[model samples]
Target: MNKILLGGLAALALVAGIAPAAAQTVEFTVINNSSYDLHYFYTTPSNEDHWGDDLLGDSGVLEAGYQATATIGDGSDQCLYDFKFVMDNGAELIEPEIDICQLSSYTIND
Candidate 1:
């Protein structure tokens, strides 16, 4: 993982207001070990018809060999979610029915 991401995680772990283990918010780490840079990350509740938005934002990029934390707090208390990882070359990887409540991290690997 990149130093920036690791440092951010360390700082976030120190901050107050982080949700407790029983909170509805699902906080998990995303590891990018694939060959391509990750351009965008999208997550939506399993019951939703549409993906809400790119969590990585417009300019944010998760380069290969890097990792980032994703927090899903839609206020719905949903545990199951669908994830989309878009690569820099326009390739997309979709993972469905992930129970974020039970996961600490997700890895995208070749």
Candidate 2:
């Protein structure tokens, strides 16, 4: 039965080697320094077809000179996303393929 024992040990080692690394969540802040209030903030997985719901829900508009903490991490193991800022006058600026884990904050200014 030594062959069986060796096979089991090898299987265990392979499983350990293929196990995923530790999870991480990046908490970043969004600062609004422009002249208009931030009406909505959107974020979605970089690979998705649509943007998720407004990240600023219920917190009200983010006025100029204010900041909000935007936590960026996927429980589904995604690490990249697109971020968008919508202003009060229906203008929007989008930054695509943002590695949210690499940012501490973002600013929208004139």
Candidate 3:
């Protein structure tokens, strides 16, 4: 009985340790500062200049001062790269760029 209890505890600990971290969905409010309406695209750092499944293309036109939210992966190793925003007109931006390595502020919820 003692051995079984210990095994159960060990299994629980293993599950806790191995489970993927919670997904994080961050929102960015992008402003279209240019005179013309703009289209945007996003790609992971690994595919900086290439469009892949990870690439999030422009959803709609953005007028000046308009904002939109872009979602990106945020769980375990699968959640790679800091989220980025780019204009099809050739502009680039990254959300929480300063906080890229600051994981402590992130609340993990699964």
Candidate of highest lDDT: 1
Q: Candidate 2 on 26-81: residue-level lDDT in tens?
A: 56777888999887778888888788666565445778777766654334356678
Model 3 ranges with Cα > 4 A deviation: 1-23, 46-59, 74-110
How does each model score on TM-score? 0.78, 0.71, 0.38
- lDDT string, candidate 3, 1-110, tens digits: 22432343344344445445663433333345555444443434342444333222323444444434333333323334544444445665554332323332322111
Q: In candidate 3, which residue pairs get closer than 3 Å at backbone N, Cα or C atoms, i.e. clash?
A: none
Clashing pairs in 2: none
RMSD of 3: 15.7
1-110 in candidate 1: lDDT tens per residue?
A: 34544444444344424555554766788989999998778888899989966766555678998888866655557788999989999999999999987999999987
Candidate number of the best TM-score: 1
Instruction: Give each model's whole-structure lDDT.
Output: 0.76, 0.68, 0.39
Global local distance difference test of model 3:
0.39
Off by over 4 Å in 1: 1-23
Predicted structure 2, TM vs. truth: 0.71
